[model samples]
Target: MQKREALEFDILFVGAGPANLASAIHLQRLLKRHNATAANPLEPSIAVIEKGRYAGAHLLSGALLDPRALDEFFPDYRAKGCPVEATVSKESIWFLQSKRKFAVPFIPEPFSNKNSLIVSLSRLGAWMAEQAENEGVQLFDNTAASAPFMENGKLTGIITDDKGIGKDGNSKTNFEPGLLLKAKAIVIGEGSDGSLTRQLSMHFPSISAAQRYETGVKETWEIPEERITAGEVHHTFGFPLESDVYGGGWLYAFSPTLVSVGCISSVGHDSPVCDPHLNLQRFKLHPLIANILKSGKMVESGARTITSGGLDAMPPLCGPGYLLTGESAGMVNMQRHKGIHLAMKSGTIAAETLFEALLHNDFSTGRLKSSEERFRNSWAWEELHAARNYRKAFDKGLYSGLVQAGLQLGIPGLSLKTTQLTLPGFTETPSFNPKKKKIALPVIPEFRADGMRTFSKERSLFSSGVMHEENQPCHLVIKREDIAEICLKKCKKEFANPCQHFCPAGVYEITTEPVPALKLNPSNCLHCKTCEIADPYGIITWTTPEGGGGPGYKLS
Candidate 1:
C-alpha cells in the first residue's frame, strides 16, 4: 500500500453539484462579510471534492429552475453571465388517452413558472463551480469521496476512493491510496443516493425515512423550427402507462429548435417488470408527443432518479461533525416537481448554520441543528410541509394521487393528517407488481429509431459520452448471485435480469444464446444510479467508478 495523502480544512464538501457549490459560495460571502466587520478577522479554508471529471459531467435534470433560491444565492445572477436558456412565457398541462389528448387551461401553481428559467442544470452547476472558485474555495474535480469517517456514531470526515487499482484486486504501478479528508465540519452534497451518505447510514441508522423515488429518462433534441415556441413548458399524464402505473411525460421547448422530452415513473410502483426506459420510448410513440419530436435531431440523452418522499423523506440535518444537504438529504419537494432551487436553499441554510458554528468553534450536532430550525422557518419549510403528503398519496396510484393532491390544495391543513410510510425491513418496498411481472416483461414493439428523433439505447448512451476503463473492476457490482436467481424466479425464467429494465443506459442484459446469464456493459452507464435504487433484490451496489469514468456532459 502506498502512503496516502492527507488534507485538512475548516469545512469540507463532498460532491461538487449544486448544493456543494451553492453552500460554499454562500459561506465564502459570509466569511468575507465577517472579516470586513470584525476586529479579529479569520480566514477559513473551504474545500470541495467531486466524483465527476468536471463539475457538470454527471449533472442531468428536467432542469426547470424556480429561481427563488438562485436569486437569494446570487442576487445579481444575470449580471454574472448565468446561463438562462429562456424565461418561461407559456405553460400547458394535459391528460392524454391512447389516441387523443385534451388541453387543460388550468395551470397548477407549481407549473406556473412565470419568470422561472428553463436552463441546463449542467450549465448552472459548472457556472457555480467557477463562482465558488472565484470566492477562493478549493475545488477538486475527478476526485471521488468513497465513504465518511465515523467515530462512535459521529462523522469526523471522509475517505476518498482508492485510485489506480487493478481488476485483480491488487495495486498497479501508479497506485495511490485513498486520501483522508478531515475537517472541523463536513457537508454531504453528493446528490441522489450518495454513496458516502449510504456509508454513513451503516454506522448511524437513518434518522429519517428512506426516500421514495421516481426515475426520469430524457432525450434532448433540436426540434423543427416552426413547431416550437421558446420557453414553453408542457406536461402530460396518462397514456403509455397502464392504469396501475404512476408516471407522466414532459416537454420543455426552451428554444425554437432545442427541446427536452422525457418520462418519469415511480420506482415503487406495482409493476416490477415495467421498464421505465421503455416507457419513455413508448411515450414518444404517442401521437401527441410523436408529432413534436418526430422531426428533431437528437442531441443528448440520460436518466436520473429524484426524491419524491418530500418533507417526510428528509433525514436529520446534522450529525456530530457533519451536515447533509441537497438530494443526499432529501430536499426535493415532489409537489412542485422542482428541486433545483430547493437544493440551493438547503445549501444556503447549511452555510448559515456552519457560519455560526465556525464562529463559536463548535462542531457538535446540537450546534449544527440550528440550520434545521432556520430551514423549517424558511419558505422551503412551508412549501415542503404542504407537499409532505404528495408522494405518499401516490401509494394508491396516479389518479388517486391527483385527487389527493387536489384535496390538499383546496382544503386547509389536509396534509397534517399524512402518515409516515412504514416500509419493510432488511429489504424495502418493491417498485413492481408480481401479478403483472411476467406480463409487463417489456414487449417493446418492433419500433426502429429513425436516427433523427428516435434512437436506440446504444445510440443514446453514445450521445451521453460516458467512458470507463474496461479492464478496471466493475463499479456496478452484483453482490449476491442468489439475488439473480430470485429475480429470475420472480420473472419465472432462467437467467432473466430485472436490472436490464430499469437501467436506461442498457448496461445490464441477459444473453441466452451464449451461456444464459447477465452481461454488463459498464462503459455505457449514464451514472443515474437507478440500478442501485430500484433493484427488487437489493443486491446491486453502485460504487465510484474510476475517477472520471462516467458520462461527460456534452451540449462535450
Candidate 2:
C-alpha cells in the first residue's frame, strides 16, 4: 500500500449517527460559550465522516423518542423543526396464539409510551445533521471509516475505505487508495457491531463476557386510514416465536394510514434458524395484525441489530485520544426498548469532556477518561443500571423470563442480581447429527407472500433501495479458506447451511446445479451485519465495500 493523502482536524467523529451528530452540535455550543468569556478565542476544525450516501441513507429504527435528551439538546426541539411522526396517545400489549390474541390487562411501566413521539429515525438523522452543519461542523457522507489509525500503541484517527478496486484483487483504472485522517481527538459512534469497533476491541480491553445482539427486521406499510388511528402503539409476544425463543413484535402508526411493523429475534437462541425476517412474516399472519393491514401496501423495509447487552457488556468508553459513544458503548436500556435518547445523551456528555480538553490543549487518555466519569454520573447511567439484567433475563425462555421480569418490577434491587447464563449467542446454538436417523430441522412456520397483506423477502428488499457496485470486491469475507468444505461436509450435515436461512437480504445461497457449493451475492447486502453475529462458526466478516454502497433508507 502506498502512502495516501492526509487530512488533519482538531476533532473527528466517525459514523454520522445520532450520538456523533449530537456530540458535534453540543461541542460547538460549548466552544461558543467559552469564547464569549475567555481572553483568547479557540477555533478548532471538527468533522464527521459517514459511510452512507447521506447522513440518514443507512439508518433504520422503530423509534419512539423520549423527550429527556431532546429537552436538553435543544430546549425547543419541536419549535426548532425536529421531525416527529406523531405523539403517542394510546398503547397496549398483547399475547398472541396462532390465530387469536389476548390483551394484557395492565401495561408494564417500562413498556409505556404515552407521551413519547413516533418518528422515522432516518429522517431524524437528516434533521440532526442539518443542525450540526448550522453549528459550523463539517459533514462528510459517503466516506466509510475502514479502521482506527494507531501510532505508538495509541489511537490517533481513522483510515477511510478504498475505492476503484476490482473484484479480482487488482487496482482499476480509476483506483484510489483510502485517505489518512489524523485528529487530536476522535469519537466513534458507529451503531451496533461496527467493524471499526471490533478492530479496536482486539487491541483494547473489553467486557469479560461476550456482548449480545438482537436482529430486528422492519417494514413501513400504507394501510386504510380508518383501520387504525394515528399515535396508536401496540406490542405483542408469542405466536411467531417458540417457547424457548426470546423476541416479540411491535406496531406503531406514524399516521392514520402509515404504520411501522417489525419483529426482533434474539441471536442467543439455541437453534440455527433464528431468522428475524421469517419471524416477522409469520407475525403478520395473526388475525389481529392481518386485519389491520389486509389492504395495506408495503412502502419500505430494512433490518438492523440492537446492542442489547446493556451496562454490563459495555467496553471502556475512552482510550488514548479516542472515545466511544451510543450503541458502540452499549448505552441502550433494553427494558424500555429505547436507545436513541440515551445515545444522544452519551454524545452530549462526550462533548462536554472533549470541550474541556480543547480549552487546555490536551488530548490524552487521562483527559478523555472524564467523559466516562460524566456518563456514569448522568441520568443515562441510572436508567441503564436499572435495566442491566433485562436482556439476559430472557435467556431461560419466554415464560420464565417474563416471571423474572415481573419479579424484578415488584421487588426493589432484585433486577441487579446477575444470572449464571453468560454464554455468547453463537456458542449456544446446538448442532445436528447427520448419523442420527431422526435428525430434524428447526421448526419455522411456512409462509407465502400474497404481495398485499404479506410479502416475500425480495419484495420487501426492493422497497429498501439497497445497491452496491457489482465490480467491487465482495465485502462478505469468509475467514477460513475451507468455506466450501465446511459448508458442504460439516455445516451441511450438522447445521444445514444456516447462513442461507439467516441472512435477511438473501446474500448467501447454497447452489446445487453445477455442484453443491456456497454462493454469495454481496450486492444484495442491506449492511445489517446479521450474518456476522449469528453464524455458528463465526467465519463471516462483513466489511465496507465502496463508499455510498448500501440501502437508501428514507422513510424507515
Worst 10 residues of 1 by lDDT: 423-432
Scored by lDDT, model 1 comes in at 0.79
Report the lDDT tens digits of candidate 1 across residue range 1-556.
4466778899999888888899999999999999998998868899999888899988888778989998887898899998888888788888888888999878867546788889888888899999999999999888888777766777887888787888888878887788988898999998887878877777767643567677888878887788878898988889777656667888887698998888888664323455677777778878878898876677888888887777866888787788888898888876768898888999999999999988998888899989889997999888888777776666666777777777787762264334565532113434444454344244435556666656678888877878887667888877555445664454336214557776888988777675566678887887787887867656677888877778887441
Task: Write down the worst ten-residue block by lDDT for model 2.
Answer: 424-433
Clash-forming residue pairs, model 1 = 270-432, 270-433, 271-432, 271-433, 272-432, 272-433
C-alpha lDDT score of every prediction, in listed order = 0.79, 0.85
The root-mean-square deviation over C-alpha atoms between each candidate and the true structure, in angstroms, is 2.8, 2.4
Predicted structure 2: lDDT:
0.85
For model 1, how big is the CA root-mean-square deviation? 2.8
Position 311, candidate 2: lDDT:
80
**What is the clash count for each candidate, in the order shown?**
6, 0
